[model samples]
Target: MIEMTKRIRDLEVSEHLRTLTHERFGTRGRFTLLERASGIGASKWKNFYYKKQEATTEMIAFWIEKYPEDESFLMTGKIPPRKDGYPFGTIPPHVRQTETISDRLNWVIVEWTSPRGAALFEYLEERSKHQIAAEEWKKTVLGEQAPTAAMVEIVCKARPYFAAWITCGSEIDSYDQVDPTCTRSIKTWRSNLLKQLMSAPSEDPEK
Candidate 1:
């Protein structure tokens, strides 16, 4: 029974590898080309497809790293998420925005002590200490040191005002005070963060 189970598993793995190879190369004639691209020897690659030898996690990781866009499919045997127009996975817009905000915040931390000459300069001065205190308090409460989604949302909400102040010398006192449109934008940003957290791929196959 154990040997039977192993044979079944090997067959499944072989079929998956064959399907992936077909999807990638479209023809068996390109098997050598794939072997060259993968940096795995021709005999080893053939053994993998024939189920004469089992593929290791290290081998799978190497392939995934070589083809990052196919990592999801290779690892999970599912279609990868598509971007706006691209067929393969691309970075989501909200993720890009979050990264931009994070970069700007890092710049602010290094380059500026405060929004020194802006009209909301006083508010920034008052809020800076409070922001630090709030983060510290949150760390104490969560007990885990890593920043959570809620923590990221707090920073995300502040990004637009920071950008406006840095770029245009705008006098926005707070995120809420921006405008109805800006308020909607903030809500949308937070919503996207929530959605991303919720939709993250589960590690457990049963899930």
Candidate 2:
């Protein structure tokens, strides 16, 4: 349990009420008020709790009205989101070789931040870019013609504004705007394997 106080940590004066919302309406425990709390739409509330997106001033006001005694929270002007670059480091060669996707996710969103002291407190801070070199990797690994930078960049940075489908879940979003590293050649491997399977003879002798 994250012992939340009357004032929650890391939230700005503008976003401060966000923490209170979480505290009063604990997301997991029994008797939690998240769904029961009335005002903001479920989408906005979910976005705020999971760090999927920042809440707007209008939404903030909605919550502020719910907690009238703390209405003074509105006086604090909206502080722009923190810009300290968080999600970057040269991925070690060994990590690239041995780490699974889950490992990479944990590295960025958990192990990396906890040691650096940014996990809970600076939850809303900015993240560093994770742009992979797709064209170069294609030329070297798949021996395929490299696509134009524009093409790969277009695909790589193309995560939808809202998730198109549930991915189970990922730690991709700190503030939910970080560009996810695209799966380029992995798609190629899948295509080639499918072709190989289609061309192979079936083992059934009875046919």
Candidate 3:
């Protein structure tokens, strides 16, 4: 039973990683077992105990950033009524208004504080489409399709912005405010997580 459970947990880890790579990196590939275990905190096989617990904490933080009512606790330092309402400092301070497309709509540009942030943003803007197709070809634990030339183009286009952002300063307090900074420590952890997710394999033979 223990061996059977371990095998099932391992498969779960793989599928999660595969889905994440496909959805986030736009790649269809296989994940090494180690990567799957680390990526989504799916190491346990005792039901949804681990995933549910961790996701709950993360979701709380996510919601705080997404709404205005959540701002009072953040801005005023008042204790929140809900247990989840811990004091979260100002919104990441990474996003700012870029050129305005119209009255209510403006392009928001994110200032990356580290190479990983730049990498992630670039992947989202340029490499994402290719990743979509790449996800379709995922095998057991490796990716078959390499990222395309068009994906490379998208990455290159984002280079200028990244370089410019770095030169001006890594932190963007606002549209005009920039600070030379290093978010490498934070990014390292995030990258490790991604590596895990990108390497997972799926249980569903059809997938």
Instruction: Say which candidate scores most in TM-score.
Output: 1
Per-residue lDDT of model 3, residues 1-207, tens digit only: 999987665555444433333332332221232234233332332222324322233323432433333334433334345323211122232232211111001011223122221233344544455553422212111223333444333433544323223333333433222222224423443455467678897579877
TM-score for all models, in order of appearance: 0.34, 0.27, 0.24
**Against the true structure, what is every candidate's RMSD?**
20.4, 19.9, 19.7
The per-residue C-alpha lDDT of model 2 at residue 52 equals 68
lDDT of 2 by residue, 21-87 (tens): 6544434321223333454566666667667666566666665554443444444543334224322
In model 3, the Cα lDDT at residue 178 comes to: 25
- Top candidate by lDDT: 1
TM-score of 3: 0.24
Whole-model Cα lDDT per candidate?
A: 0.45, 0.38, 0.33
**What is the number of backbone collisions in each predicted candidate, taken in the order shown?**
0, 0, 9
lDDT of 1 by residue, 63-109 (tens): 66544545556655776554333211222222212233333333332
Instruction: Give the poorly placed runs of model 3, Cα more than 4 Å off.
Output: 27-165, 173-207
Cα lDDT over the full model 3:
0.33
Whichever of 1 and 2 has more lDDT, that candidate is: 1
Off by over 4 Å in 1: 1-14, 84-207
Q: Which ten residues in a row have the lowest lDDT in candidate 3?
A: 99-108
